[model samples]
Target: MSLQALWNQFLADPGRILNDLALFFTLAGAWLLLATRRREQRATARLVPQNEAQAVALDESTARMNRFFYRFGYGCLMLALLVSWYSTRL
Candidate 1:
């Protein structure tokens, strides 16, 4: 079937939509958190030799980014959970 046809079929089932959205947001948030953590770790590990100062600066930046991503991820998960709960009540 065409993409539009498939989308229409998918939307015809509200339960599927809710479940898919919940799964999507959860997975996306988890992936973002993992990626941010990995980047922060790599930046921290680079603090050696002549680049120690620069590495420290980069590590701090990465840490900030990691914190932002972690917070964002948590917010997304919380919002998604709230939405799912609200949907169930309706």
Candidate 2:
């Protein structure tokens, strides 16, 4: 189909598009959270800290990453919820 046709279709019913956006964000957030958790677990399992300082540094780094990823993933989920709610009001 042509771009014009797609645009017209979208204009006719934007709720469908918003629903799709919500689904995409929901999946993306869940996948990001799960993938990063698995990756971090595997990485930490394979690494061995030689000293107390090294262990502390590793722990700090992991905690920092966990915070960032969790925040971003939750943000995506919140965005998806907002989009879904907005679509329902349409």
Q: Every model's Cα RMSD, please?
A: 3.9, 3.2
Please report, as a residue range, the 10-residue window in candidate 2 with the lowest summed lDDT.
49-58
Clashes within 3 Å, all models in order: 0, 0
User: Candidate 1: lDDT of 75?
Assistant: 81
TM-scores of the models, in the order given:
0.65, 0.77
Instruction: Encode model 1's per-residue lDDT on 1-90: one tens digit a residue.
Output: 899987897678766677668778878888887887887777667665657555355646666767889999888788778767755664
- Candidate 2: where are CA atoms >4 Å away? 47-57
Residue 32 CA displacement from its true place in model 1, Å? 0.6
lDDT of 1 at 4: 95
lDDT of each: 0.74, 0.86
The lDDT leader among the candidates is: 2
